[model samples]
Target: MGGSLVGRIAAVALTIGSMVCARIALAEDPCLKQVFGRYCLGGEVDPLLQSVPAPAVSQAAADSLALIFPDGENQLYVLAFSRRIYKVVRAYGVSTQLRFDDTYRLLREKYGPGEDRSQFPEYASTPAARLAAIRRGEGRAVHQWMPSPTWHIELSWTRELGISLSYVANALSASRAARIESGL
Candidate 1:
């Protein structure tokens, strides 16, 4: 009878310890901080934007909306669906190789080295040649980081859009993909 009581006590302690550990892990997750400045995934847009000045332009679509704010030469785009922010993007007008490298280093330091998913032709072996190809719209430079299952970060450069850093909510993206796959 005493042994049964002791076993029950031990099991309760183990369960409580597991719950505490899980909560701590979630609080320390870096991806939680990777969302838009003060805004978070699945959070409402109005409350989050209250502290910031009004966006320079706003566009709405069938299911999503975008708010564009000017930041010097760059543009910050906040995209949302159902009034909840799902993605944030900062686009730099001057897309130089140096700028791309600097941004890449900063992101690497914070999130560890991301996957370099740049696509270049066989002849574009050197860094300079790759940059030239990208400028000519023949290739694209992409670096991606999946810090957690719920968040994704990508830094990409293209001739049409220049250099942009994007943060995406994976759950929202998966839902969009599902709709596309189902042709709905």
Candidate 2:
């Protein structure tokens, strides 16, 4: 009888411990609800565009909504659904080259060197050529980093387009994400 009671107690203790651990893990999911100033990647989408700030201009597509904020020439673009964010792009406008440099410096300081760097050369012979190359999607550079197992960040730049940042969530499976994203 004593042995049976001890076994039952151990089982109960284990169940309680497991429940506690599960709660902790769920509470600390690294897929940040907010990564940038106030934007979250891969979570419930904001109801209003003004949830952050009124965009200078906005566009919508079948799968996404884009907002452009021209404040400070930091032309920020955000793509989100009514459920989650899929992509974000922030342009530097006129200060494309300078912003690109500053963004690289900041990323290095914050997250160390990126895991992968894909940089295209600027082969343009003239200023117009460089601009043309950038417009043609040439001379584009991207540095990617995995800040956490669930979150990935990409810093992209082009001579003519300036700098931008992107964040993605990789923790959820496609089917599961689709369900959550669809509010099902």
Candidate 3:
């Protein structure tokens, strides 16, 4: 009887220990504050490496969102999380204005200063959309966007219950993002 009690105690101890560890791991999850390129809180992004493959995302933070400017300028920024390359979420001719205060307001509206409540998993998303946007590369996530002349893209990912919510922000540069600003 004593042995059984000891065994039960051990099991309880272990269970408590495990629960603590899980909390610690979850606490480390990245959020919008960690917004940038590929960020992994628990696992890692496994590059297909079919071709040379963009360098093996050396560090989770190093993984980038490659933006091929309409000007034919291609820049890789640590703003993309990938199992593959990422694409700027765009709707052809929807040219977003680049205003600082307005951009901040948008962010405040979409996500407040803490864990967001509305970031639920999107189920109706098509397979391609899921494959394209969901967290990949060892649970790493990236936020993608394209600045419309006079703006630079910004991104964010915040966590709740160990999941990440990736989002984008368009803060304009002093110049324009496109010559035409309206086209496919």
**lDDT (C-alpha, whole model) for all candidates:** 0.80, 0.66, 0.34
lDDT of 2 by residue, 18-127 (tens): 99999887665333647656666665445446565677777875645677766575666666654456555666656555666788789889999986575445566665
Residue 90's lDDT within candidate 2 is 67
Q: lDDT per residue, candidate 3, 1-184, as tens digits?
A: 9999999999999999999999887655423222234432122224322324344333343333333222122222323343322223221122122332354456556545332222324651553343334333222122333333312234332221122223332221111123124331
Best by TM-score: 1
Extract clashing residue pairs from model 2.
45-83
Number of colliding residue pairs in each model: 0, 1, 20
Q: What TM-score would each prediction reach against the true structure?
A: 0.74, 0.61, 0.27
Cα RMSD (Å) between model 1 and the true structure?
A: 6.4
Q: Whole-model lDDT, candidate 3?
A: 0.34
Model 1 bad stretches (over 4 Å): 1-36, 48-52, 180-183
lDDT (tens digit, per residue) of candidate 1 on 1-184: 9999999999999999999999887664323434545556655566545546778888887667788888789998878776767788889978888998999999999999989898998889998898889889899999999987777899999887799998888776677667657876
Tell me, what's the RMSD of every candidate?
6.4, 6.9, 17.8
**TM-score of model number 3:** 0.27
Which clashing pairs does model 1 show? none
* Native-to-model Cα distance after best TM-score fit, residue 131 in candidate 2, in Å: 8.3
Cα error, candidate 2, residue 11 (Å): 24
